[model samples]
Target: MVFNRKHIENLILVTVLTTFSGQIYLSPTGGTFRLSMAVAVLTVALIHFRKLPVMLVCGTVAVTIPLFRSVVDYFSVLDADFGDIFRSYLPVVSFYISYGFLFLLLSIREKLSHPLSFILSLWLCDSFSNILEFSLRQLISPANIVSDVLIQIILMGLARSVLTYFLYNTTLYYIERYDRSYQENRYREMIMFISSLKSELFFLQKSIVDIENTMKDSYDLYRHLESGPQKEQVLSIAKNIHEIKKDYYRVASGLEKVLSAEEDRSSLSSREIFDLIRENYQKLSTNRQLHIHFEFHCRTPFVTAEYYPLISVLNNLIINAVEAIQQYGRIVVEGRLEGSIYRFSVTDNGQGIRPEDLELLFIPGYSTKYDTVTGRMSTGIGLCHAQEIVENHFGGNIHAESDPELGRTTFCVMIPFDRLQEVFIP
Candidate 1:
């Protein structure tokens, strides 16, 4: 047998449990018939707890249970002689020692996964151990060991074995479910954190593309205005834009490095992503104290490598829904994989857009919200940016539908499945 600190600690635990539970027994005062919970406990502990070294623990428990009980018995009845007290309990030692060797011959660990085989092994161990103890008792003082006693022992052993088997499997069933639930929650948290990080990264990257276009257009204007009266002014504007572009480029590059330094955690399950999006939006708007209900209509899981842009697009739509609502509303985010296309819809019960404005929602600098206090229109670029990413990066299209009477709006995005998976750098 092998041993380690952990293995020894387990041995000690098994011994302590066996000794204490062994004390709770149904034994007739002068008869050898005995039934103890300790037998069931020892079988369960040894079988279920794979870390314990079986032979060593069984040997230790065989000695500990009998010795510990005898010492406790001697002290409890101070008037009784320790020798007779120990001798009367002597047959139990043979029972445990024989049971351990018998269990070793059975290769108990391998049978655990097979419930029927496991129960049979336990029954054999318990029945044989009791017979050994009764035989030892007969040796000390002659008594008839009848067939009736044999039948009773076997029946009791079978009862305990069946019960242990049921209890172990039932406990395993619950534990498995708990672990899956814990893992699902953990995945949601991790995706939320990554979504926050990569969403910012996406903004910086998108800005780089805009800065490049601005720089090129400015340089072209400078060349066209050369030798003209406004030559110096246009040249100055081009140089200034170049400097700003350089700064933005450096920042975007640094963020790219920060993301690339870690392992590739690019892809995530769509079910958790959808659930997290719903939960995160709900929590962020809680301070509004509105009777808003957030709902997710998709639980089917798919894998996506374009989570960064995907989340950024959904964030804009959800934020738009929040801003649209005043006091009470419901927001539902739904996703479906249809044929070769992945479709997502964000629907909300808010102040709906007019039919004319629906076509203009994706246009840059177009928004329906007007700030009365400041006498200014909102920045209005959020939907435009989402459309840009969906159309350009994902090869997808986004559109809006509004039912003015019902006061509801739904923004749907549909992308080819292959396009989303192609976005992962690694």
Candidate 2:
């Protein structure tokens, strides 16, 4: 085994239960410990493992400690007869039967997964086994059974069950904290990589713009040339220049998006930020010939945030909404103040998401868009990057909901106002 958390937990339970085996004797006869402690540890182990065969093997190994003690004592006192030896084995047999019965009860009933049910099952099983042992020795009477064996078993089982329940919850708490820290570190690394890429694209975009202007001037000079042998050569050169210009325009357009994403928006208000995004998308809508209505609703005129990331998040969501539509759709971007939180949403009447695919939508390298003929697809990091920025940097939340049949999807982002204030004020 690779020794993951589950394996480590199993090892701890087995070691602890076996070490405490001879510590708390509850019987007058020579049983060396309170069986309830081992039972409680076994119950916790069963909850973790859930597999019956694994639990049975672990329980068997744990019981061997106490059983060995009983065997050594019996042989040391040689005056003991066959009857005495048989009596010495009674507690071990009862302990095994109790754990087996409790396991069977839990396995059969789905509702018995609750701690209360597990504790009740433990009490009943332990009490029954003890009663059987006492009855065989003719030590059980109606009054004595109620006051002595039954009450003691119930109290012991209850204490151990409660202790084990708290321990299990504590273990889960630490595991979650560790996972959250690891994810935050990954987000920081991604942010650094994106910053470096944007810097390179910005310089490249500037150089392409200069080249495009020079090409435009050359074409204008060629148009002015007289009709002659030199004129024909100049015209051919102009044609080639025009084609190269077109290629540069396409490259520059993509670079613009990458450059715009990292713009310093630290000083922009919420309304100003939305207006900038609206202006950019308006051109996109006109170019694509898509009749998409865009609307922005902001209750608060201004809210402070790291402007670039806020812009990037809203831009990605709006673009995703626009691309989802086939020909025509309505996109509504809304912002408001809900107490100490800034809430923003993008709702689009486009091709909606499937229920099963909704959860995977924000995972990196996972996309719903695919072009079968050309074998081309989206990089699938837009939403994932947006989520990392909102949650990790701003301590916020982002989620989406969709109705596939109605072709409507809505993405919502919530950032704490105090969190934004911390970034902008300092």
Candidate whose lDDT is highest:
1
Using TM-score as the measure, the top candidate is 1
Cα lDDT tens digits, model 1, 149-268, are 677778878988898777667777888999998987776666666655666666667787787888788778878875965877777887888898789888878867876664257576
lDDT of 2 by residue, 1-426 (tens): 355676666666664664465344466333432443555455555555554354454456445644555566668777756456545455555555555665575552343458677556655665565555455444422233445655666565566556656666676678789989777555443444454354344434545666677767766777888878777777677678677767767886776676566543335576666776776678789998889889988777664646556766787788889889878889999987788888889999999999999999899799987654688898787787778778866789999999999999999999888776433311
Candidate lDDT scores, in order, read 0.78, 0.66
**What would you estimate as the lDDT of candidate 2?**
0.66
Residue 261 of model 2, lDDT score = 67
Q: What is the TM-score of each candidate against the true structure?
A: 0.59, 0.39
Residue pairs with backbone atoms closer than 3 Å in model 1 (clashes):
none
5 in model 1: Cα distance from truth in Å?
A: 5.9
Cα error, candidate 1, residue 172 (Å): 4.1
Model 2, residue 366: distance off in Å is 40
